[model samples]
Target: MNEQQRVMQIFQAYREVNQAFFQVMAKVAQKHGLTPLQLIVLRILKEFPDIKLMELSDKLNLGNSTTSGIVDRMVKAGIITRERTESDRRAMTLKLSDKGTTLWEESNDMRLMLLRPLLGLSEEDQQQFHRIQTEILTILKTIKGDVLHD
Candidate 1:
């Protein structure tokens, strides 16, 4: 194959791998009663409970309307609470409710269970995997943006 053809084949393989990974994650999230995007939002909220809607959108790389819809659904499901900042009083912040915390913990347990076999790899192999994944992510981020902030 020509160099260009070889590069296209590699790119296609990468896309397939990513799609498969996401599909598995989606199935797992569905089993846990959450969509993959909802799970991601919950995880982000767990880490940054005081995040604003705009900040959340920026962090998630989602449009405002899309993030708002997710937030609305999560709120209705009692998985998240929107509260006004005490100081700002008008500015809103996102936080996980007790229910949300429980769901997050359970989801984390499920993920850990699924990852146990990967964790069982030899220490060197595990480290190598981490290093390589990080390098690939760095390259992807760089391609998307100059400083690779994400």
Candidate 2:
């Protein structure tokens, strides 16, 4: 196939795969009484114990107001807490609450259960896939930066 055709095919496949994966995850989230966005925020908070609201907004590609609304809802639900930075009282940082941590842990367990079996490929195949995925991810990051960098 020509270069353009090959790139298009790969892009289409990637989009479809991601769509399928996220659809499954959406079902999982619904089963847990959480939306995908809420789960994403909870997971991010777990990864970064104390993250700034502005930083989270940028990282999540959300508007400041939207981030604030999401955080407010999460706080009301006891999933996360936002507090002033100890060193800089004016700046706010977010941390996962006990409920959030529990949800995050459950989500992780579910994901691991699904991924472990698929990762049992031959060593060579695993290595090849890993290398290719990394390359593609790097290229995607570059493209994303070009499009979104402010």
Candidate 3:
């Protein structure tokens, strides 16, 4: 195959892998009575406790209004807590509630589930895959503005 065909084949493989990953994640999220996005929010909050709405929105690559709606639902569901910052009363920070923490912990199995397929590869293959992924990510970031159009 030519370079263009090879690139298209790689892209299709990546999409298939991504779709399979998300399908597994969606099932896991449903089992926990949460959306896939909500599960992602839980993971983010676990990593960055007491993060601001705008910061979370940036991390999620979502707009403020959309993030706000998700946060509102989470708050109502008692999965997230929003509290006024002591330094800036006007600003609010978000953290996972006790329920959210438990859910996040329970969802840890999802990582193993996702890794199962990758584990089938030889160790050398895994290392090469990681290197390729890192290189692609770096190249993509560097050329993002010039070659990639949103």
TM-scores for every candidate against the unseen true structure: 0.83, 0.84, 0.92
In Å, residue 71's CA in model 3 sits off its true spot by 0.5
Which candidate number has the best lDDT?
3
Candidate 3 displacement at residue 135 in angstroms: 1.6
| Candidate 1 deviant stretches above 4 angstroms | 145-150
* Model 3 segments more than 4 A misplaced: 110-114, 148-150
* Candidate 3 structure quality by residue, lDDT tens digits, 8-85: 998898899899889888888898999999999999999999999999999999999999999999999999999999
Candidate 2, residue 49: the lDDT equals 82
lDDT tens digits, residue span 41-141, model 1? 98999999889999999999999899999999999999999999999988999999999999999887887777577667899998997797788788888
RMSD of 3: 2.0
Model 1, residue 85: C-alpha shift (Å): 0.3
Per-residue C-alpha lDDT of model 2 across residues 1-150, encoded as one tens digit per residue: 999999999899989979988987787688777888888898888888899988899889999999999999989999999889889999989999999899889987886776677777899998998898899999999999999976
Each model's lDDT comes to 0.89, 0.88, 0.92
lDDT for model 1: 0.89
Candidate 2 wrongly placed segments (more than 4 Å): 140-150
Question: Poorest 10 consecutive residues of model 2 by lDDT?
Answer: 111-120
